[model samples]
Target: MRILLVGAGLSGAVIARALAEAGHRATVIDARAHIAGNCHTERDAETGVLVHVYGPHIFHTDDEGVWAYVNRHARFRPYRNRVKSTAQGAVYSLPINLHTINQFFGRTMRPDEARRFIEAQADTSIADPRTFEEQALRFVGPDLYRAFFKGYTEKQWGCSPADLPASILKRLPVRFNYDDNYFFHRFQGMPEDGYTPVVASILDHPGIDVHLDTPFVSDMAARHDHVFWSGPLDGYFGYDLGRLGYRSLTFERFRATGDWQGCAVMNYGDPDVPFTRITEHKHFAPWETHEGSVLYREYSKACGADDTPYYPIRLVREKALLSQYVARAAGTGNVTFVGRLGTYRYLDMDVTIREALNAADAFLHAVQANARPPVFSADPA
Candidate 1:
């Protein structure tokens, strides 16, 4: 069987590798010049710091199989993401932990004490929170919400918190303890050499052919037995139903001598501040030390026709448009929509790889049964 993978990211690469190993010839193509999509990483030419070209990607997941899968390709060094935030002229730990709460209010309270104190601050009136603003106010209260969440959410989403869904705030958890690790996943680390080699190793199979800087055309699908599209769902259909809402990012890059922010990520919660966060590339790979540092001040805005889409702004309007696209995708034959963009969801690296593996398994099973493959392996709904 001949397989066509429309993107060279984790989803496409993993599926291609799985099919290639199963005696299927896979052809992987990407519009970008590089292979690893947004996860693409390379050593800085002058500073030698491994820069996450698009943005920072910390590999963290609870899935044992996913953890082992990445380890097989790349050497991963133990790295925990301890994020910090600057708001109202003070630096505080992220996720509104005990330390952050205590520091913000200038009160050194124990776990139980802090929890009780926060409950008092919360707005008990709003029983059923519907919006991001209400969720934050109910869970953490006005002070913490205004200081940590409100401004950041507004800047990141390019809208007032009242306009965003409550599920957006539900992603982040508030802890009574002082543990400030951003994620609670059991397996957490960074690729020792970076993500590019991990993906390069995956696509190195003899049955696979990779083409960089090559865009997928509509006619290309007819030439292959099956197509696994990791590109945008709207893009595959030529955006006839109108463009899906996405928040694009713009980075202002700069260089420093050593230790710029003293952390991997430093988010600005001040609405007046233009940029959302400043990422120190050197901090991402703490195992290796270098004299120079590379950083990017990230700014988020409405995704334009030319901008690189980062976050899916799945507001009411976007969800309606997405449903139309999903229906069209279901009707289409010989193609399976996979990955974050294809499925129209913001997926983490581990989730993306897991779904890709599942998609490949489903394809192999369909082949065995002499049946048609699914349009989507995971339900977008």
Candidate 2:
């Protein structure tokens, strides 16, 4: 089979490599002159810092298989994400650790005492929290919510926390202990050579043909035996049902002589601040040292037609639109929707790779059975 894989990101590269290994000729293409999509990383020529061009993507996953698969392509240096946030002219540790709670209240309380204090501060009246604001208030109390989450959530999603889903707040945890590690995953690290090389290595199979700076047209699907599209789902159908909502990011990049924030990520929790976070590129790869430093102040807004979409704002309206697209996709023949954009969901790098592997396996099985490949191996809806 001649497989046409659209968008040479992690999803496309993984699928292309799988199909190629299974004796299928795969042609991978991307509109951008890059391969890693949002995870694209490169070296700063002037500063010698490995810069995450899209944003900071620390590769952390509990899946051992996915971790081993990534390590096969490039060296992964141990890097733990320790995030700090500034709110109301004060700096505090993120995820509301014991130190953060003590520093905010000006008391060195033990873990149990801090837990009791937070419980006392929490609004226990709200039994079943529905919105993000309610969840924050119930879990961490009003003071912590306002200082840390309210402003940040508003800036990140361009909406009030009351309007957002409770599930968003569930991703964050309030620790009674002093552990400042952002993620509790088993394996956490960044690629030694950066993400671009890892993705490039994935697509370097013998049966795979990569065409950078190539835009995938709808007509191109008809020319191939099968198609694996990792582009936007609404884009595939020409947005017949209205455009799905997404939050896109804009970076204000600058260079400094010495260390700027002394951390990989420093989030601004005050809504008064225009940007969400400032990520210093040099801190992401602590293994290498350089005289100068580079960083990006990231701002999030509603995605425009020309802008690259980052987070899927899966609100009520967007979910309805996604369901319509999923139905249309199911009826569409010879094409399988894959990846974050194609599935119209926010997916981490590890989940994206796992799904790509599963999708490839499903395709190969279908080929052996002499059956038609399904529109989606995993349901987007």
Candidate 3:
């Protein structure tokens, strides 16, 4: 069977490799000149420092299978994502933890005391929150919400917290103690070399043929028996159901002497601040030594036709449009939609790879059983 995989990101690369290993012909194509899409990393010509072209992606996950799969390609260095926030003329830790709570409110209460204190501070009146602001208030009350989430989320989404859904804050971690590890994933680290090399190695197989600077058109699928599309779902249908909403980013790069903000991610959690966070690229690769550092001020805005969509806005209109695309993709036989763009959900690198692996497993199972695989790997429609 000949399979045409679109967009040579993690999802496409993984699925393509799986199909090829199954004794099937797989052709992977990416519009960009590189294999890794937004996660593309390359050495800076002047500084010689490896830079993440889109944003810093920290490899962190608790799934043993996912961790083992990536480890086969490259060794991972021990790394933790400890983020800091600059808000209201001061810098503090993130995720509404005990340290963040004490620092922001000028209180040194113990964990139990702090929990009780926050419970009292919480707004019990709003039992069920419909918006982001109300959700924050119910969880941590007004003061902390205003200090941490309210402004930053507004800046990131380009909308007031009241206008956004409370589901946005679902399952966000909050610590009782001073443990400031950003993610609680069991396996958390950065690739030894970099993401680009690791991704390149994943697509390095004899049976798999990769074409960079190549875009997959609908006509390309005619020659192939199956299609695995990682591009935008609406793009597959040519936006016939109207374009899905997404938030995009613009990175302003600059060189600076000494440390910038003393951390990798320094978020500006104030509505007045234009950018949501500034990331110090040099700090990302902690093993490397550099005199001069590179930083990126990440500004988020509504996505345009030409712009790359960083985060999907899963609002009512967008969800309805996604349903239409799902229907179109389902009706169109032999084509499967996978990954963040196809599903219209903002997925981290780990989640994307995880889904890809699942898709491969499902495809193999279907091939053996002589059944049609579902259009999506994670969830259908």
Task: Assess every candidate by TM-score.
Answer: 0.99, 0.99, 0.97
Candidate 3 Cα deviation (angstroms), residue 68: 0.5
Name the top TM-score candidate.
Answer: 1
Name the candidate, 1 or 3, with the larger TM-score value: 1
Residue 268 in model 3: shift from native, Å?
Answer: 0.4
What tens digits encode model 2's per-residue C-alpha lDDT throughout 285-358? 89998889999999999999999999999989999888888888878889999999999877889999999999
- Rank the candidate models, highest lDDT first: 1, 2, 3
**lDDT by residue (tens digit), candidate 1, 1-381:** 999999999999999999999999999999999999999999999999999999999999999999999999999999999999999999999877999999999999999999899999999999999999999999999999999888998899989999998999998999999899999999999999999999999999999999998999999999999999998899999999999999999999999997988999999999999999999999999989999999999999999989998899998899999999999998998999999999989999999999999999999999999999989968877
Stretches off by above 4 angstroms in model 1 are: none
Candidate models: Cα lDDT each: 0.95, 0.93, 0.87
- When 1 and 2 are scored with lDDT, the better candidate is 1
- Candidate 1: clashing pairs of residues: none
Off by over 4 Å in 2: none
Window of ten residues with lowest summed lDDT in model 3: 372-381
lDDT agreement of model 3 with the native: 0.87
